[model samples]
Target chain A: MHFGIISTGPISAEFSQAIKFTDGADISAVFSRNAESAQAFIDQQQLQATAFDSVEALCASNDVDAVYIASPNSLHLSHALVAIQAGKHVVIEKPAVWNPAQWDQVWGAAEKHKVLVFEAARHIYEPAQKIVRDYLVGKKPKTVRLNFSQYSSRWDAVEAGEEPNIFSLKTGGGALVDLGVYPIYDAIYWFGEPDGVRYFPALAPTGVDGAGTLVLVYKDFNVIITIAKNAHSDAPSEILLGRETLRLSSVQGIDLVTEYTAGDEQVLFDSKATPGSRPLSELMRFEAEFFCDMIQAHLEGNFDEARVNRYRSLTLLSRSVNEVCTNARYTAGIFFENETLEISG
Target chain B: MHFGIISTGPISAEFSQAIKFTDGADISAVFSRNAESAQAFIDQQQLQATAFDSVEALCASNDVDAVYIASPNSLHLSHALVAIQAGKHVVIEKPAVWNPAQWDQVWGAAEKHKVLVFEAARHIYEPAQKIVRDYLVGKKPKTVRLNFSQYSSRWDAVEAGEEPNIFSLKTGGGALVDLGVYPIYDAIYWFGEPDGVRYFPALAPTGVDGAGTLVLVYKDFNVIITIAKNAHSDAPSEILLGRETLRLSSVQGIDLVTEYTAGDEQVLFDSKATPGSRPLSELMRFEAEFFCDMIQAHLEGNFDEARVNRYRSLTLLSRSVNEVCTNARYTAGIFFENETLEISG
Candidate 1:
């Protein structure tokens, strides 16, 4: 399948390289707001691909069969909607969008255009994540803790007051939006939408969350999700599945998986998956292929609404985290640019 | 200086070896209720030391100069007071006694005898701990989380009710008495006594805390401590100073120390502590040498009253955690062997 790459950033470069190595996919085109950045990406990869300066032009291009959206969290709705309208299957990156309104807008457009929309959260596709889900198959998971905190170089810029990008409220950036989404996705995916959630955030200067902790009280198990953009801990990015714990030592970019029993030091099982370097990017490619598969399955009258419902569940989870993050900012006395949010039930 | 080792347990054996390695200390005698156990330790170590079958005989023995009390938590007071009455300096293991009344008795006896009393908490003697203390010389630490939860084999035995030991409330075994003491000590040592504390315990069937969360609210910052006996988490035993955090990988055993700026992942300093060939037993040796150092200093009329006062502070902390754990058990509708703990302060 031919895939269109979006937002020619460092991450996009990694995806393009992974696509070059993948067995069945081709990076057919590149899209960026700046024509030079797109051309630079094409030249760097030395690929026979056209560069489109706008999302509309990229969606209208004949060379692409599906579009991969790696733009900022705020731009996901606009890019996904444009691609769906152009009859292109969609693969959107995390935080899916800034809020549920954008999620609904993108999903509605994808349904009307008969295109598949897959969130490119490679963690969900990784083997470690599968092991976690497998471990919690039948047991009642009573607690979940997901922690992803990486000290970023961009934090230096934020501290120096170089107009904040996605890590600032103006750009829909905060610890919850940027780092908290991983645990949020894990909670909703593993357990289902929580009946309710209590969010507490520690605010940073310049109207963004420096760090935040969310406690999602399920009927049985409670989930604690910690997201931080400013601090570092030795805590691995892990999913605690009540009876056992599924650990990815380097949750930041891990292809390996290990399971630890409730009280044992010895890991029960370990699968150091041979995902050929750049596993995270390969997950992006797999998501793209899955989108094409879902689209074909839908058109041939063999659609699995049950599976589609899972995808819709992803939409709901993505929107829920964005809601929590936005609301946390409001509660922390941080004034965001998008103040007119429609509070949803 | 000469030393008496009370209890022929694993910790005492290790401490005996440590005294042999110390500069000015000798393992003058050993004691246990069972003469066979005391003889076994002497035979195994090839130490030319007198062995006694009871604390009274050991305290009366002229060969002993000081006593290192490594017996179970419940036996600390009786054994330490016996040694003190016989004019022997005493070093008691952590969670020194079952309650504060016992601690007061031991303290009064030591003062009357004009003998030094030491608590064998080895971390305070470690260079890393001194560095951390020096690093925060003038700063009022906002939060201090000291976690020392090792999934002990005794937990399984306690749950089975076979030979219930310290992990059973009937035997003074619980997360608070066993593991919670570390965080309590850290809070007192770093931020002095907290204004208030909130404890959430997962009680065992024996009405002891298996694992739980603790929130210590100080004047400036809130400290969070978690100690679990039934489950394992990769939480570094830590003290989060206002300006930085000092993290140790394990409680009872700290082989490495890392320092991070407050609320940041960038490690300002990390001493990837080199692990020696001898496993956890080496800490006992360090404790022995430090105990002798204090003894000699005291006998030489250079005793530091501040060190003894710090131990008094730790006693107060242990009392507070005891109160909270006892009350939390009641809230969970669990009754233990000693449920009439007066927690009202």
Candidate 2:
């Protein structure tokens, strides 16, 4: 898989580094608004890939098999449409978009072009996710407390009276769209859709969520999600079953996961490396491998019903998470500048 | 100070045993609807205490100076009033009362009798509470996540199709009233009154909350409280400061507390005694000593304005927590029987 990295950012750099750890995936190209920045990223990473100043040029490159979209969040739909229209697969960053309507446009274009699209929620592809799912096979869980709070590295810029994209509402960015997506994906993919949702965000000085608590109401239980971009939670995320529990280091890149039943606790996954789980590049490798495998399956064309169902489920889960997160954020008075300027949007 | 135990339940037994750890406090009387039960409790603990079948007899006896009201939740106000009206100081269990109105009645009676009233929020009296409070003295915390979930011992009876008082709505029982009050008190006592509050309870079969998430919204932060009676949480409660964190073993009986600042992690308070703390009785001893000290202060009427201020602050905190917990629970559709029959009540 030859991937064309979209936008020269730290996340795109992570994607490039992650691709190196995969079996048969590599960065074939890079894109940035500034040609110098694109070339600088290419040089910094010492990649043999071409650097394109335009999304169209990167998407049209014959060497590129797919486009990894790490552009500013509000521009995802527009950038994704360019890639999909040019017959390239797409992997959008954490949130597909600010809302489902925008995601539908990108996803519809992918289906029309007979290509696959994945929201790069790398944590869900972690082995701990399967362990957590298997741990709850015959068991019913009542409450799940999922948290992904990291004090943003760019917060220093904000403190100096500057608005980084991650803390600015104009870029469709906030704690919910940034850190909250990990747990939102975990909750939806594991427990299915909630009956209702409510979010109470601690809005930042720049009119974005610095931190927040979201309650996903189910029939018998509530999944509480805590997320932040200006503060960090040292405690691990956990699911409280009737007589059991599953604990994850965090909702993102879970390197340590434990299951407890009665008087016993079993460590399901413990990487024993990196204080905050396997390094981001190493953990992100799983998503790269998964996406490459899916692309291979599409190229192979002759697949069984079970394979089709897996792909369908993954895409649906992605869409559902985007919708749930966007709607939940709207309830907390968080709004994006694109698609809808409506207050209660 | 001589104390009377109201109700022969587990909490009453704890209160009686806890007195043994205090400097000058002991259970001198026991009250129960069944005389045999009261006698059995006194006998089981091997305490030199009188057994009375009625609240009137126990409260009116000169053998008791204060009444430790550990009766069923809904009966707390009535029992406390009986003791207070008899000129006996009172130490009611966690909630004090279901609502502020009910608490007002007990408090008023105590004021008229010139006797002290205290909520047995033992956790706050733990040395760890002072450590956490002092740690956040000059710092601003944007989030505090408090969890006190214990898989209820009485849940087995609920599973056996019996509505134990802790799981019975008729008894003003639920996770909020039973377990949630600990975190509620921790939040209010440490952070003062929240600007607003909301609770999302996981209602049990008997219309009581089995587990729940309560959000106490401060101006710049949200105190997220997680509590359960039908399940357990192994994760510790934590305060998310920008560059520092304080982790408690749980929101209650914090045996271990660690503070992390920059690269240095400090063990602020570790009892080196018990896993969950110096046993419940040992922790409860703090409240016993505090109440006893307060009683002595009142007796020595030559006290300064600071002493009066401390008493006023403690009483106001008790009332504020009662009001906050009651209002928050009502939002989650939990209600007690003794209070107004209003649907939202």
Task: Give every candidate's TM-score on chain A.
Answer: 0.85, 0.93
DockQ of each: 0.11, 0.64
lDDT by residue (tens digit), candidate 2, A1-345:
789999998888888888888887788899998889999999998888998999999999999888999888878888999999999988998788778878888889989998989999898888878888887777767788988778887876777888888889888878888888888898998889988999999888888898898899988889999987887666788899877888887787777888886578988888786547466788888889988888766767855677678879989998889888988887787777653554346
Fold similarity of candidate 1's chain A to the true chain A, as a TM-score: 0.85
Error of 2 at B33 (Å): 3.8
Interface RMSD of 1: 4.6
Q: Model 1: per-residue lDDT, tens digit, B132-248?
A: 666667864433445544455666775577546755666677776677776666555556666656555555666676665565656544556666666555556555442355676
TM-score per prediction, in order, is 0.72, 0.94
**Highest-TM-score candidate:** 2
lDDT of 2 by residue, B135-178 (tens): 77877776889988889888878878889887887788888877
> Per-prediction fnat values?
0.02, 0.63
Question: What shift in Å separates residue B11 of candidate 1 from its native position after superposition?
Answer: 2.3
For candidate 2, what is the recovered fraction of reference interface contacts? Answer: 0.63
Give candidate 2 misplaced runs (Cα > 4 Å).
A21-24, A34-37, A43-46, A275-277, A300-304, A338-345, B34-48, B261-263, B300-304, B338-345
TM-score of chain A of 2: 0.93
